[model samples]
Target: MGILLRHIFILIIIGCSLSVTVIKTGWSEDLLFFTEQYPPYNFTGPNGKVSGISTEIVQEIMKRTGFAYRLKLTPWKRAYELTLSQKNTCLFTTGRTTERENLFKWITPLTENPIVLFARPTSTIKIMQLSDLSEYRIGGYLGDAAVDYLVTRNIPVETVRDDKLNVRKLQGGRIDLWVTGEMAGQALADKTGHDIKKIFTLTAIAGGIACNLHLSNLITTRLQQELNTLYQEGFIDRIYQKYNPDLPVPVYKTK
Candidate 1:
């Protein structure tokens, strides 16, 4: 009877140790990050590595947290859907919209993403409000919060696969205005050598990291705390300065 009891005790101890190891692995497994080719935020550089404003910020956060991770640059729609469906995955430089507020655990306010309307430099279109442009044709891209915002307001907007196409459409007079994030539009325009001017600032939303719903809150909470520390330490500011020294650094908002 004493020998039998000792074997049972050993089994219970081994089971408990295995359970703890499983829990630790679940929390510390390498994270996968997804992002789109929205330049100046997250994009593939000429060297073919992902590097940009939000990309750098996220890299710093991961480094400080000592989390093993891999980042991929893909189409916006693909990245959005993959992040939505996968566990232990995250999407960054995502706009924090009401429609997406509860979809994922968030680490936010990485950058200011002011939705704006860009028109050809010679164009005379004016927009005082979103409704003011009802008479004019508008263009937006897929997987962008601005597209959803327009559709929600019952606004008619032609859709494209990418924002760069909208820049081309605006240049070709196919669309009167291109609605997109301010910095992204500027970067695209500059890259394509097309001069576009911002005609209206529709609304400002913060860009953030959106982790999968099943992602452990423990990881999210730890990352959020590290992000806040980065902001407080002006590390985020220095990153923005490296990208665009003229643009004002976005203020961090804790949730």
Candidate 2:
């Protein structure tokens, strides 16, 4: 009976070792992707799953790459910070700005959205130049490239946690203008039934997947290649059409 017990104990130890190995292997194979609640780009749908144009694009790319990944909807600031600090982590629909050029390894030009200023439809706000923005109370969201662009030019901005809130603020006369992406602004306005108009186009910006500085070049290269194929095959155009049939699809570049 003692001999039988010893044999059973040995089998248990081997089984425990195999389980640990499987767990570690699964963990190492998985990648984590983060994004904010930017609509028609990346957002939590009514069914509680993350689904949008950019989210769909990323999912297809990962499927092509055969890499296991987790997509999480988080605050913009937290998502950006996690991509910056965590390995095997990435953020999608990130603006590829000159100031951020050196911070992360990029798989770029996933989106070519123009940053713009929005205001109430009835407001007569003329913005012929960037300097004119300093005269009004400009509202924006935290960790957005549009806000950074304005702040770098010495323009003061009121920031909030969500860009959607700015639409309400504009309606309430709390802010004179709101700075955000053209697509995002329109989506927010339409969803909230707010009447807002684009007052001025700030600048055209390309957005993409931003990976940590320490991420493997292999993974970045694979994602870029897959994205290029998607663009060439018109898969991306279909995604854009599904979201907004009238909006022009963002051009993607191989380089």
Candidate 3:
């Protein structure tokens, strides 16, 4: 009886060790994802799962490269933290910025998005340079990079919880300019009854899929290489066209 009991205990230990090994290997684990709506990028579908350009790219990366992952859409700040905190975690369509460079291992050149400054039709503000933004009050997404750039350079600005509110405030004559992603701005302007027009194209911002720094470089490079191959084959463009019919997909190259 004692011998049988000891053998059973050994079997349980062996089984538990294999389970831990499999989970750690990412072969038997459901990986975690972090994202926010940067649109035509990541967002929640009507069925409450992930759906967007970022989601599409990530799905292909997982399928083609055999990485297992699942996505969760949350606000940007929390998504950023969650992605940075977990193993086998990633955030998508995220702007590859100097501020966040060290926080994640990158799979970059995902998409090129234009960040622009917008103004109401009634306003005739012309922006020739970033410095010109200081002339009037500006509004944008609370944690948006443009606002961060301006504020870091000592340019005074206002932040709204989201871009929709910025349009409303602009329409209400509360702000002279708003910074936003061009694709999103155009779509949003068309959707909402706002007479927002681009003051100037700020710059072409590069966004990508990134994993927490704790994730192995092997995993990061695997996805990056697969995406590069997809880009060369024009598959990324095929996915982008699904989100916005008129959008012109940019060519990807590694620096």
Candidate 4:
């Protein structure tokens, strides 16, 4: 009986020690990084590996921080939900909005995207302001920030699970306007061979890594600082230029 009690005590000590080690490591086992298939930002490459501008930047950050992570490409809605519910989970290319300000710990801005209203070349719609879009049939992607923005303003939006479908909807005259990132829309149009044109720029968004609120402030601060350094040292510019050589790099400001 004495020997069995001693062994049980030893096991308890070992378990406690492992718990402390995990706590000190910040991420449990490995960090969970989630993203969707947004081309030019993050998408599966020809080799089946996740590759894109934002993916490269995130890879560099992980390399610099010496952190082990598991990257998964999932639906944006599932990724967003996991980031909100799980600890030490992160979702990338998330737009920073006033409504979402306190929901997650924002690490760093990965890209600056102009949210625009797109219409078919032959469409006769014109959007001078937010209110002007109310009359038109607006198509938005599910779990996108643009949809929430429109909904909050009392504008009716037709949401689909896949953003690519919006392009088809607009082309077929199913929806009058498509709200999405300008570059994202262009990339989709290029892929589908559609001639979608930007109708108006709704707003410019700084999208970045949004970690679960349970994430340690220390880890978030460290990442933010490292990303700022990368931007200032022009490493971010180099990565962006590699993917978009024809376009001028936008200046990144750390907030």
In angstroms, the error of model 3 at 115 is 1.1
What are the per-residue Cα lDDT tens digits for candidate 3 across 1-255?
A: 999999999999999999788655754566677777666677666897778887887888788977677777777767777788888788877777787788788887777788888888767788898777767888878766666666767887788766778888888888888887887777677768767788798777788887888776667778888888888887888887777767657667664
lDDT for 120 (candidate 1): 94
Which stretches of model 1 miss by more than 4 angstroms?
1-19, 253-255
Off by over 4 Å in 2: 1-27
lDDT of each: 0.89, 0.89, 0.77, 0.87
Over the stretch 143-186, how does candidate 2's per-residue lDDT look in tens digits?
A: 89999989988999999988889999999999999999998899
TM-score of 2: 0.87
lDDT accuracy of residue 23 in candidate 1? 70
What lDDT tens digits, residue by residue, belong to model 4 across residues 108-148?
67888788899999877877888887678999999898787
Regions more than 4 Å wrong, model 3: 1-28, 45-49
Q: What's model 2's overall lDDT?
A: 0.89
Deviation of model 3 at 105, angstroms: 1.0
* Stretches of model 4 off by over 4 angstroms after superposition: 1-23, 246-250
Q: List the residue pairs that clash in candidate 1.
A: none
Model 4: how far residue 157 lies from native, Å: 0.8
- What TM-score would you give candidate 4 relative to the actual structure? 0.88
The candidates, ranked best first by TM-score, are 1, 4, 2, 3
Measured with C-alpha atoms, the lDDT of residue 128 in candidate 1 is 78
